[model samples]
Target: MANSLLKHPDFMRLWSAQIGSAFGSRITRTVLPIIAILLIDADPNEIAILSALSFAPGLIVAFFAGGFIDRNQKRPLLIVTDLVRAALIFSIPLAAFFGSITMMQLYIVAALVGAATALFQIADNAYLPRLVEKDQLVEANSKLESTDAVAEAAGPGIAGLLVSLVTAPVAMMVDGFTYLWSALMLTRIKKQEPEKQARDENDNLLSDAIAGLKACTNHPVVGPILAAETLLAFFGGTYLTLYMIVGLRTIGLDPFTLGVIISLGGVGGFLGAMAAAPMAQKLGLRTTLLITLALGQLSNFFIPLAAAMPEFGAAFLALQQIAGDIFMTIFVIQALSLRQRVMDENLLARANATFQLTTGIAVTISALLAGPLTIIFGIAPVLWGAAIGSMLALPIMWLAKEEKAA
Candidate 1:
């Protein structure tokens, strides 16, 4: 009974908007790299730089963004970010029309889009609980995630086809348009949002933000998870930065085939999301997260090994694609649910922002490291490092037993 969040009109609107946006987002994800690789001949270093630029703003602004979000209306920010992203993404197509598109423009677009993504994610996650009952959080998340998996699974294939037909630039306009559609859907939803709490005129923004960080870092359950999550992001960042390079240059897959391979991963994520609740029930939430993290990190090792042996690279990457998504999805769902269960509702945005900030830092480090390391030792060694470094989080997880709160 608690699981039927979709029956609610507001949630349905959010989900509907999300469906189009998710698929469109995938087109943007796939096309950008395809443009860099197939169209403009971007080298490994350039691709790494593009990846770095994409998420850099999160590290810069995410720490304090939480306090600001908590003090204001969320829906407007979400709408504005969506529209801004639409404009930024559309600029690429506009420039291509005038024969003025450059790698520089792509870098700028990626950074701006990433910054918007950070804000949207924090605001959106905070907003969802307002739309449903507390008992339904996991179920709401699961439904959202499962449908998201479906869109992601389909997205790459659609993106591949679109890019094949119209080239990366023209095809990518679909993503820009989708953002506009998402904003339109946001406007259609009529749920009255909770009034924003007025901030104390004397409150220090940094201190308020730090309080959220303390909430996460001081909590028994979340503390270790935060540590593990950051490591996962860092190592995962390294893997992602090198992943396309190994796929295109090392194993030699075409764009469409590569897209198909990525879509196959969505199958694994879909299965994992469906299983997340049951797994939490059976293993206990904390244990479930530990197990998933271990498995996800384990799957990452096969990634580099696949590249090392080209004959098996495609097969290995395919397995990792599926396996990695499954483990990570389960880990993410349970871990986040734990936060919702424990954290104060008022602090939800800040807690989530704090959470994002740490991962952002990890991502920044990984991005910065990936370019130089891959340039020097090549993809295999760096991948090996990423796999080994992921294990550094296990000790933290092992000690993260649940304790009763005062």
Candidate 2:
């Protein structure tokens, strides 16, 4: 089965691009914050805004990007977005070298990258179904997910080393090269299918977007999935911010130790993605999702407790990170596979857009509140609070009958 999956040419091409992009993204995800904090000397509030700006464009561009992607060729969209992001990110190092880099420039670059990323995401999800057979979907997604897991595990450590060696801004240049590499790989792939002509007949982008929104809102499975994902994002976002703060400030772990802890989760994610197919076959999708969801929520409690207890905090944090990553990998692979299987190809991009938009909104809100909430309630309280919020999603999952279809 693995051999067959690995042999599929289109999947291989897509997987390569995804791996390259994932590596690049991890560099930014780690180095960008470090730059803001260490280089720019940003306050907590400014850091929060930086995070929010990075995600905010998805909320604004997702629906429109979906509509646009649905009407166009996926390959070109992916290539163009990757190229644009590459150019934008490459400018960071250039501006820094010239001693002209500003916080405003950073914000603008992040936001613009986010916008281009929105289009790429929509196009990528929509393009997947066309690239592989339906039965191979899970396997293909697993391979991609596994690559992401590997990237997550390796990218930050590399970024940390690179930043230590050559500063944060210079480290970003590595990601710029990765994006260019991804774009080149994408361009080399031959997509025989022509672009969809559906939007050419329609003159009104607004009307089309609204209709796409309605479709997602009306879909029984997709709507609930979006709701659950939103809840997860809300809690997960806050938990992430708190996790970093707690680890660095409260627990007093050094950067290297923190990186290792984060990397451990990526190892778990890789294992989880590798195990997803068997687990799904054993537990069924519905059972697996519910179990993982519960486990995911339970996992967050460890973070706060880890923060409060110094002696065993590192171990607890590592365990929590692993559990969360495993749950997330399983949840994403199954949920996305189910979505792709059920939704019409024509509407897939819009459905994915809706999910992305919900996540973006939830993350934005969480980023905004996380700083203030941490200050008011402390990082431990914020962590526990987000854990509680995650549990709220279980009822939504139950009420929506997510188990029935599976």
Candidate 3:
């Protein structure tokens, strides 16, 4: 039987770290684009490039990092990466203070932070199995994601407020501080991590990355879900690259109202996190996954629709945030639990790396394409195409045979 996450101090520390990190991520997501639009007067192409830079490094490095993560302890990597991200974020505000912050600097920061986040996430996925019994993964993930959901709920609003009051670049200082907080919380964990097994002398990053990629593709359940997720990731990139521009510039919502609309997603995410396990229990994991995945993809239509109707933009966006986040959160929780339950502990990091690699590639391509597509066809059609592309994931997922959770 799984122990209560509420009673686990080390898990709580991990969860707390996630809280700060999640909030920091949310703020960065909000402010970076706004800074590009408002401060730098960048066009859609530049915004798309900014978005692409964030995921491009992960596409390049995550597979190798996954290999490295499996050969080392995760805790130190987690801490160091957090510090690095904090430093990177702090550099932005410092530059802004001197009135020298530029789109190139923002691009560099986003890329570096993306690479660090890729490492942190892979290590985190592998580390979790070591921290708790296999049976506890769902609950543990639920707790962690719930914290993220709370941050998601409030982070953007706080970011918007800070941006409104202090300006966008200076507002990034809050994200830097959150990373420092994350690092501090991580230091408080007392759990002794299991030592990595000694690798063969012939083993290297390339071989390990290849092995990871093979493992994920050869697995029955993992392979299909990975494909589906890659498709969704591509479509998701398109939405993200355009959403801020569409809202702030196209539909003309103020930053605070935009933040509030986005925060509704966090509220929905919290509800989804809380409901994931229960829904899995009641509906079975397969059914719940299908329902949520379909709903999540379908919900994205609202964005393009919102752009088409500026008068009702806020209402459409709010609905999109709430319904879309709820479904996506539920899908993510159940999907992650399913992956963790099935993969061997030693291979988990590599498998996750492979997953990240594919999705990162997809996202990068989508982000790069989104701007060009928008320039050619305009915002509404590009978004409509993205929404249509995202729905393709449902059939791919539907074709995969479900595995009973261990």
Candidate 4:
């Protein structure tokens, strides 16, 4: 199975581009906030706003973007979005070099880049069905997710080094280059995407978007997955903010150490993605998802404990990250494969957009809450709370009867 998946051309091309892009995203993820907090001297609230802005566009634009993507080809959208992102990222360094960088400007740029990212993702998900045979969907997704895991592991460490040597704004230039590389690779892919026919002149955009949402809400599998994913996103986002504070300020770990720990988690993610197909084959998708979801939730509790106990804290934290990454990769692959298998081709973009919207909203809410929650409950309590909230998703999954299908 692995050998055949590796040999697939479309999968290879998509995987290569995704790996490059994921690395670039991780670089920005590490350096961007650091630049805001350390260089620009932004406050915690401002940082929260920055994070929220980055994700908010996705929540707002996903439905419209989905409709547009459905009316167009995926490959071109991917290429255009990549190119636009590359340009936007390049502007960051340029502004910094000229002594014109500001927090507001950075916020705007992050929002724009995020919106473009949403468009790219909607198209990319829609494009996958055209790339490989139906049976290969799970395996192909696993390979792509594994590449993402590798990038997640390596990108932050590389970003830390670059920032240490060249400064944060300068480090962003590397991410810009990565986007360009991704765009170049995308340009080389020869697949012909099916174009959407023109709609009636009287067609209503709002109605179409609403119809898409209804389809997702009404679907048996997609609805539950979205609910679980939204809950996961909300908790995960809060955890991320708290984790950073605990790792950096409370524990006295430097950025490099944090990067290494994150990378270690990536190793687990890669292993998880690689193992996903076999696990699905053995346990079946529903059982695999249930097991992984539970594991992911349980691992969250360990993070706060690790923060409290400095002795062996890093190791415990690393283990938590690895476990979380593994579960995330498995869940993502399974969810995506099921969506592709079940949804109509024409509704693919819209359905995916609906999912993206929920995730974005959850992330935005979590980002907004992270600051106050940490202040009130402290980082440890917040992490523990997130773990508890995550576990609640299990009952939803169980009640949905996802395993019956498998």
Candidate 5:
């Protein structure tokens, strides 16, 4: 039976914090690349590099972050990271106001914000188990995902208006304030977290990091999920690296249209979150996961097709967004719930970290290659290749039938 988290005040606060952050984050995601493409006139190479910087910090620091999170208090880490992200994001608008903005400054901010995001993600994942009962993981995650979907649905439209009324750089002010709001909500949570486990005198950060990797790899259930996620990340990264560029520059989508299309995906995401538990209950976890993962990859075919046909681009993109987000959101919620359910609490942070590190490496590599690949093969062919490559994960999922063998 699903435990009711409605009476849990701390969980509510966390949920509240997340709602603001998710909305603000969607705004930032919408404006950041638009700022680069429109205001900075960044080329494909620069855009690829920017995307790479966003994922590289997770690749570089995730192992250590996982270990550190395992040994320390997550609440403080979450608070600090929020504050840092707020400050870093605020810099963009500040620079814009001073007429000192440059690609180099944007690059620096992306790298720093990415680092803070990596830490915040690891800490937040680890902190959740402490906030609610194990049985409530799905419900808790579902609520969070739903909030994200709503933000996803509305944030871009709002961002589009902001970008139209003000400039993209100035529009980032909303994200900064949202982060501040998230931090304040986090501070009000009065739940006492579990005491940190005693660290061995001989155990260092590296060793702890290694142990976390071992925990994931050694676990029968988590090992395959990790492998599948890493593979998907590479293809997903390649396609996403060019998505905005193609939408705005190549396909000639206006900011408002682009935002509306992206928001449609959030609507699908909300539906997916609501449907996940029921689907799992009906079709079984293994079946639901395999089907959703495959469908998500297959949905990408629309993206390249949309790019190829400019007149029908919006319709194709919208179909892909709604269908793709539904399946992917279902896959993500189930996968995360499974991980939280099976992993030992002491190693959960590290395991989550290990997943992030590996996937981050894959995404970073694919993103770095996207620009060069586009130059060599053109964006359409490269996008089609990414979509096909993502299907390679299906076999991995099929083989991971140890969850229930149903």
Candidate 6:
């Protein structure tokens, strides 16, 4: 149904940039925690605050970001953000070289990078539709998601290895350079955009944003599924907030072993990404969506349950990660594909921003709540709470009705 992207030069340029950026993002995500726990000796709450700070910018910027992105050329924004992120991340290693690395500096970097990431995401999503034809959106999105899966598969392990060979802060330099790589790739893409609509000077502040929110919420399939994703984001944020502590402190996984266990998720994700198109064809997209959600949600139960049974050890935890990663891979690709297929290109950025707004808030709330809740009820109880929240939202998906991969 879609044109092959094999010969599409612009799409290839974008894809190559994505591959670099995805891996860089993952490496930074992996190494930052190591730097926090090992270098800065961050407590559970400190880590929580760090995460909240990184994700918080989305809450602040996502609301109006779509309107901003939709009104501009995407590639320039992408290039600028990539360059800024590269500079911000490089500060970690430079500070370490001067023996001045501090938690505050890391916080600044996270916040700045998060802001850049928010802008880049909105621009990137909006740009994709313009680069490819309507029917090719799936193939494009699928390839992109697959790149993310590949990044996930290799990122942590690579980070772990890099951290072991070099210092954790030095490992961050790898990510910093990759962003520059992404920017270079972006410069080579030659696509041009259609003119932006002329905005009235009297345009309401949130007219476009409100319209996007209304459209997403009113769509039966998009509405319910997006809600599920928001809830899952909450659960995911909480799970991650506790994952470092749980794995490093309680279950006792060294960084390398932890990285390996996490990498298994990437392996699962790779397979899941490979399966999306074929599975969508064999079993309707709706069925595939529902099934993957069920599996992903079910995987959440295992993490908290593993805490109760230490005898099962890291193997159970690995199982949890593998399930969560694979199902989430499929879910993400399909969801993006569905949204791109159904929504008008003009409104895509706003709709994405609207989705980002709720999900970003969910993550922020989870990060803010996770530390204190763990202090009170402990990690296991809070994790179980996350699982329950995800489960409660699952029934909402029943309201979503559609057929086919699109």
- Looking at model 3, which ten-residue stretch has the lowest summed lDDT? 397-406
Candidate 2: Cα lDDT at 385: 82
| Model 1, residue pairs in steric clash | none
Highest-lDDT candidate: 3
| Cα deviation of 257, candidate 5, in Å | 2.9
* Candidate 4 lDDT trough over 10 residues, lowest sum: 397-406
Error of 1 at 363 (Å): 2.6
The lDDT of model 3 is 0.86
lDDT of each: 0.81, 0.81, 0.86, 0.81, 0.85, 0.83
lDDT of 2 at 264: 91
* Candidate 1 local distance difference test against the native: 0.81
How would you encode candidate 5's per-residue C-alpha lDDT over 137-161 as one tens digit per residue? 8788888998989887888788888
Best by TM-score: 2
Error of 2 at 73 (Å): 0.9
Candidate 6 lDDT over 1-406, as tens digits, reads 5447978999999999998899888887778878989988899888877876777887667787787777777888899999999999999888888988888988898888888888888889888888888667667887888788788878777888899998788889989999999999999998888877667675554887797788899988888877888888887789867887778887877877877787788777877877777778788888888888888888888888777775675888899888887887887888888887787777788889988998888876887689999999988889888888888666877778874674
- Show the colliding residue pairs in model 6: none
Shift of residue 366 alpha carbon in model 2, Å: 2.8
Candidate 1 lDDT over residue span 191-228, tens digit each: 88878888787667788788889888888878888888
Number of the candidate with higher lDDT, 2 or 3: 3
TM-score of each: 0.87, 0.90, 0.87, 0.89, 0.87, 0.89
Determine which window of 10 residues in candidate 1 has minimal summed lDDT: 397-406
TM-score of model 4 vs. true structure: 0.89
Relative to the true structure, candidate 3 reaches a TM of 0.87
TM-score of 2: 0.90
Model 4, C-alpha of 143: deviation from truth (Å): 1.4
